[model samples]
Target chain A: MELEFVDIRVERDYFLIQGAGIFAPGIHLVSGRVGSGKTTLAMIAAGLKTPDSGRVKRHGIGSVMLSMQFPEQHLTGSTLESEIASWHLQPCPVLALAGLPGREKDDPFSLSRGELKRLHLACILSRRFDLLILDEPFSALDCREKMATADRIGSIRAGITLIFTHENQHLPRVDYLWEIRESALEFLGSVPDALVGWKNKPSVLADLHKRGVYPKNLSTADILEAACRTHD
Target chain B: MQDARLRLLTVIILSVASFMSVAGALAAFIWWIIFTPGIRTIAKSPFALFFLGFTASVSAVIWLTGGDGISYLVRMAVILLLAFYAYTDRAPGDFLDLSVWLFGKKIGFDIGLAAEMSLQGMEVLSDEARRTRVAFRLKAIKFGFRSIAPSAGLMIYSQFARAEEQADLLAVRGYRGGGMVCPQFTRVKGDVIASTSAILPLIFAIMPVGDIFILLQ
Candidate 1:
């Protein structure tokens, strides 16, 4: 699917994503400082909010889903079983995928923050959407859970996937990079090409780049191979 | 101010006075104008503005329909001001404290805890309303009756979900129906003076001297 942003300007000039188009069949990572209107951009990408002056064009998209920052806000069911069932899929498989087995009768709200996020992410990611937008997906998850979430996101075959986050420690294999600079959306191009301009890139990438070895991908194996080649 | 009990008493007394007589309400209104957090706080608070606007609109409607708009407006203004004073610096679980003190352990604690939970629920509701609005805005949902029904339904369901979680937490913590708490009071000179002065409004309300409106006419 193709998503086109035509000079979008949000309220108070908070963010201006102008004349940029995203042709996506892969993962796209959006990064920015706190209060930099990353959420605003995400909302626009999901076609949730209207911009002050601009239009969004989506081509051949079946359905779109925007995963909100707060899991509680998007909770659709009272009981754990009901929440999973609300997705219109079998509850057992989804619950097991979230690592929450036999918790079908538990109240969704009674779950801890991490547990709740896991449940929500599992439910949301398991479904099929042409366009999927995740805002701060890694926030409440631990190291292991973060890796799990990242892998889960990578496995998605969605036409367009947009992830807005501040985490620079660990990231999924990104196909495209977009950042908000000085109240404007700057498309930093595809993964390896865009890594050069990523101000707050992962530590490993920065270290490898310092040693004159720019890896083709963000995966640990690729970075390690590049580092081994540099030594040889 | 240091003692929640004294603060509660002052609020109750003043609120009763304001509703009972035109003279008392007018006096309470003047007191609020002179004493309450300066005009700046009022201007900054959307709730304050909303209360003012709502009361004024009601008064306007009453006046247009040939009723005693001025008297009703004065009474409502005093009541709203009293509400602001009562809620301003309230700490969480204060109603629980007050109820337990008044009714004692078993029944008092239950009532107070319920009140405290209800107040917290209200805060959550308002916060969720704002967040829901933003979430909808992002999804290209307009603010209209059609959109509001589902939004309201979702919010209510979420609140219930949260309440269920709170109950579970309480159970895990070994909570019993009876709450045990030591009631502490800070009876400063100012508080004593304030509490004592509250009686004056009641006296004014009860006396044969009549309402200020009658003298004005």
Candidate 2:
């Protein structure tokens, strides 16, 4: 179960991606500045939109899921409980995981944006898919929630998962890293190695790297621990 | 009729004829089902069930008042037919073209633009609502009125937000409303005949057919 984008070129009026190719499994963290075609790449990779040239091929895929930036955009149930139920899973575990245990009977939209993001994450993560694409999964989330979401991403057993986000901080340990710069998708190889060349690396990581601290992990705690050790 | 102008005229004439007499209304309804889209298409519309219940209630009221319930039901059915026909037959930008052709440059274009936007908005709203429902289904939620209310609200809110953005986009493009578009129409072979047939129902209603039947009774 894998997704392959070979020499794909997607041209939009505002942005364009030319001659980009990616073939990978496991979690791939896609990062780029705003309007860098990250979401467009995710959509093309998820088979939501056709590339202008080249092709996208998925092999032996069972199910595919794409989570939009706005959690509310993916909401289809009237009540919180029904929304969880719609995922075809029990509401108890999902709600608890989402940190919205008692909001099952409440209107889904009545919750704040952060709450909705948590709920969407809980719902999408709970389901099993061959390929999962999350667009800006960290938006409207608190630091703690971001950490929790990163942990969840780390635990996913999906055949292939791609997270498209501009947020560099609090990203989980991903198998691979890719970025869109100047309308071209550049695969920067696996983690650690890829970290060396991330042009828009988060300030914390950049500071650590500048201080000669190549932390094994990017989580807040790990970076802090690495910084302290370097200081000592 | 394929032509929007001719179709609108037929809808008006038939609707007016429907209100005039029981015979005229029944003829219009029958004629619409036979010559236009037909009952199967109208029956499948989302609004069909609501109109069905409405017609039933109106028929019941007529019967309770010692009047012919069937006549009222027939008239209601004619209106529903018109609605179904308009919805099914309309194309994007056709209304704008028709309005411009009918009303000329200034006011006509504005009204047409408004109508076009409203129609497009409805289409977008419905498409988004369906996608949202599918999103629920993917999660395994059972779809029904109980589950649709809040989703409907979100869809509406999203549409409003999008409408504001669209307005901003138009403003940025220097749109101040008055414009010209080349009107296009696809004329079908039977458009003239069908439009001519619209007058027959009204004429049939104006005749003393109902009176003749009453005298015989």
Candidate 3:
């Protein structure tokens, strides 16, 4: 199932987001300031949040899975085992994938932040969801877990997927970069391509661009490597 | 940064709502607002909520069971134990900390006591620290452990002395028992949800026909 945000707009006590749309399949990055409504937009897109005046058009019949920024937030299971076992597909492996190395009987709260996130994702992937929404999926992950999760998610297939994050570098290759700036949604092109002459490109990237060696995609890795190349 | 406590307060608000059972999809909708910080910060109220839930559940069960003498004695014993447990010597801040752990971190401050203590602790600490700094300068101290520790100790001593003096002062004055003033707490969007959650059980309890079908274990 494809998820569509049809002119989605919202106005709450402090948040006022308007006219935003996110089309999915392949990873999508949502970046915004603290209150720019990046989360609000992601929530609305994933059907977890309702917009003041828009509809989440679930294009096909599908289930919705939301990976909360804090994996513990989504933990409804009493124990790790039950939660892992709660998945539709064989839930065991996903629990392992989440770095919860033992069986599912552990307390979900005992796992570290990254482990919890991975566990949440494993649950999402093990099930068949048309769309999976992950909020700040890499917040507390160590370097290894970060890359491992990126690789794992990079390997998955779903109808539409939305990931909210600020770390532009760690994200897998994606179809679009949706930025919530001042509560407005701006859809840049594909991740690698969308970042072309991107305004939000880091200072190092700007420096690289000045040196006439602009990357295909000016992500963290691309920019850092370009900086090193220029230095060398 | 202090104003940003609102966001943290948001979590407690939502958890309280969850505690009151405004859950399923609506709870899921606001889940991230609570979850992101809560996973990282942990809530202050989860345990308290759990205890409250257990108490409420037990009360409900007792009400249903029609209060036999043995069961009534058992229930009274349990209540006495719980009351005793609440009054035992807790660490200075453990009650708030427990509230935080119980509720989940983000929403931990939902227990008004924890939030109030947090703010008061900061204020008192700040006053003490400022007084210490002034004393340190009077002693012509530089930034080193030797100079700093003595000054800090003196400052803390003075703060305690002042606290005792204030207690005496309060006794001399026409002060009643209770506490001091706190910042006015305005309910954010989440508090409204909690209020609604409180009312929800009443609504559910009233729907005898459908609720009985679901409640029939």
The parts of candidate 3 lying over 4 Å away from their true place are A22-24, A89-91, A217-232, B1-217
Candidate 2 TM-score versus the reference: 0.60
lDDT of 1 by residue, B1-217 (tens): 5578988888788788888888778666655655456465465344777898899999999999999888888888878877877666567867888888999999998898888898888878877876776555434455788657756766887778889989999989999788797666556676776677777776666654555447657
| Candidates 1 and 3, the one with greater lDDT | 1
Docking class of 1: incorrect
List, residue by residue over A98-203, the lDDT tens digit for candidate 1.
8999989887656888999999899888887888889999888998898788878877775888889987766777799888777777789998899999887778
What lDDT tens digits, residue by residue, belong to model 3 across residues A1-232?
4567788779967767885464766677666666566666766765556888977787674666666565544433456775554453455677666656665667665566666777777676565556777777777887776766666666666566677777655655456777766677788778666666266655555666678765644334555566667443
Q: Which lDDT value does model 1 have at B56?
A: 92
TM-score-wise, the better of 2 and 3 is 2
Superposed by TM-score, candidate 3 places the C-alpha of residue A112 at a distance from the truth, in angstroms, of: 2.7
Q: How far off is residue B35 in model 1, in Å?
A: 17
Q: For each candidate, give its TM-score against the true structure.
A: 0.60, 0.60, 0.51
Per-residue alpha-carbon lDDT of candidate 2 for residues A65-115, written as tens digits (9 for 90 to 100): 889888887887678887777677789899998988877799775788999
